[model samples]
Target: MQDPRMEDELVIASSPTDDGISCWDLHTGAEHLRYKLCSSPPHGLASVAGRFLASSQLRNPKSSASGTILYWSWNKPQPEVKSFPAEAIKPLVSNSQGTYLAGGGVSGDIYFWEVATGKLLKKWHAHYRAITCLVFNDDQSLLISGAEDGCVRVWSLFLIFDEVRRAEAKHLFEYSFNEHSLRVTDVKTGYGGCNAIIVSASEDRTCKVWSLSRGNLLKNIVFPSIIDAISLDPGEHVFYAGGRDGKIYIAGLSAPGASNSSYGNHIIGSMSEHSKAITCLASSADGFLLVSGSEDGMIRVWDTRTRNITRIFRHTKGPINNVLVIRQLQNTSPRTSNHTLASPLRRHGAPLPSPLEKFVNSADENAYVKVFINPHTTSNQHLDSSYITVQTMENQIKELQQQGSSAAAEVDVERLKSEQQRSLQMIQQWKTMYDNLHQFCVDELLDPSHPGISSGQPM
Candidate 1:
């Protein structure tokens, strides 16, 4: 069996003017599958758990037409599904588990959908202006969004779904940082969940790092030019900001170093090779490789440690706007002998999810209520487990009992009981193991054969 880690890494890039999405093998620089008929805007491309590719189409600014989102399976070059959203979507993001997808609309509204059912779970006015970027935190519990209004907001998914909490809270968002003076460009979250740092770039020629736990700005870095995209290093030591001046600036995070660079404080260094402005940036899993897409219609893979260009892929049709680094699909592997071929009779890989709803349906209120009663009952698999606790489950059971029991509610209560029992069993098992270890240590110390005691350590 082939190790999944050894699987090939693919770099996918899209352009606003081009009609196709380009894919290339990261290590070998060999071109792979190219999905056709996609004109993706900046931050519009998304990969759904590597099962398929999706991109929000760029519409003409003069046209009043509805926005379109297309999805393509791994083996097909053509889009399998097309969705018409109410307004043009500028940014699209999906959690690591691919269970939920979110899009930022030009109308300043955010649309969130369940990937499994294509149901619009929530739609709320997220910003005063169009949202420019959206990112989920490490645990997928909080969604951090940036808008053209120069504001960055952190939203807790738990509060968003709980109507009772939403009614009582002063604001839907947990934190709002309005430090930038111009349109915000990109936002990236670090590893820690509540304590993680969020880095946001803007046309104000500044990048600000905000603390998720404290809800305050941690570091504000001034750059020479507007930053369109930023990628956080895996180690959280430094982050790379792609500037309109065709340079990728490396800013220190936890690294113990004084900024001596001429650019500004926390500006450690830069990598410059692109002739035109950089449009997008993505860091590899190992933190050593960085992939950048530029307006010069080129994609450059850099070895960050060596500060050298490892490989370059050109997108000759148009300037690259979005870039993503994802693992190669297993079924699409070249070495697989039984690989299924793309056929007109049937699509390849997973079937396309249903089209996203343009508006929230009031008829789905029952479903929303169920989700509020038990967040885990829905298909939102990516929700952090820390949010669900034994006390929370017990309280939910009491509420359900007060509301009168149906078959569904009874089943949920039974499941919660089982979970509580399992947790108690686990605690007992851990305590027994600790007792055995303690007894063993006591026996060893009392034994005359013990080296230190027999030798009279004082002597």
Candidate 2:
């Protein structure tokens, strides 16, 4: 029997030069479906829970039109849905649950939308210059962004949704790291929730690791060339940096022996296979394999342990910029002899989400509502239901208080009081019924009129 893990490994790669998006099997190097008419910028391609593929289009240098976002179904060659943003969006990211999608505009603003409703939920200034990269933390509660201003900021989604808390806080960002001198190219988060470490690469030819818990830089390693992308190892022992000099530099994390390496401190080694600048890097589910895309229009899968190229895929039309390793979708693959075409609705099962809005609706300023649901799964997933309810109600109450709407608060209090009274009345009714039943039984037993009791059968 073949291993499911090996069969499910897939590699998706795209370029900025109108080469569309190319996908291939990670193990066998066989090509899958090729999506067309997509010219994506760096950090623009995303897979929404393997349901569909989305990419932010690269705007023409002289075009004054709004930014375009395209979505393609797995079985379709062309994009099925399109969205126009207020500005040219460069980088896009989605949460793990696929409930929200975030994009960074060229105007240095971040636009957030609810995926299901396609409503623009939040828009705020995130950077001084064009935003470059955006990534979510391990738990999806926080978002980290990097930009041309050489700044990286962490944002809490909970606070972003709570208007009252946002107004009360001194700053919107939870933590801001302004250590990089040049434009930040990429940012990645480690495994821990609050204690996770962040690795950010920059055009200044350096990579800095920051500790989230301490909100400080932990290690900084200067590279031989500017790093455009980075991939953290699954085990958190090391991370790979893709440099403009066409080399994948391996830097140590928790592992030792970095001080003795010839490349420099904390620099363990390097992998050289691409002929041109390395554009992006991604690691496999297991830490043994590393995949890299390059300006030479080639994708190479390297055996990290042996430092040898295991497989190579060529994207001949343009320079490969974005690469992702995801689970293979059955319907996305080529049709076999027994396969038949499915209807559009049947292919996705659910209707496509509406087009994302360009701006927030001013008329309905208080229309935003957030609901958190716990998915029913077989795995051990623990959630504090009461705590979540309390937190949500507290935020709503705070917002009401800030609005100076005492009438709304009083109405809610009265409604809750009425509910409490009804509950107490129902409890009293149950107690009265129990007492009446007890008295009837006692009377029947003493009067010896009940057939079942047998008038003191013990005597």
- The number of clashing residue pairs in model 1 is 0
> For candidate 2, lDDT tens digit of each residue in 1-459?
335445356788999988899887777676767889888989999986555678999668445255699988766778888999898889998776566789998888999987766778789998989899999887778889999999999998888878799999999999999999999999999987768999999999999999999999999999899999999999998899999989999999975535777888889889897899999999888878999999999999999989999999987579999999875444443324222323223344555677888888675664456644322122222222222333356687788888998966896889799879879998999999999999987887776556655744553
Model 1: per-residue lDDT, tens digit, 143-164?
Answer: 8899989999999989998888
Question: How does candidate 1 score on lDDT?
Answer: 0.82
Minimal lDDT window, size 10, model 2? 376-385
- TM-score of every model? 0.80, 0.78
- lDDT scores in order: 0.82, 0.82
Query: Between which residue pairs do clashes occur in model 2?
Result: none
Residue pairs clashing in model 1 are none
TM-score attained by model 2: 0.78
RMSD of each: 8.3, 16.1
Question: 349 in model 2: Cα distance from truth in Å?
Answer: 4.9
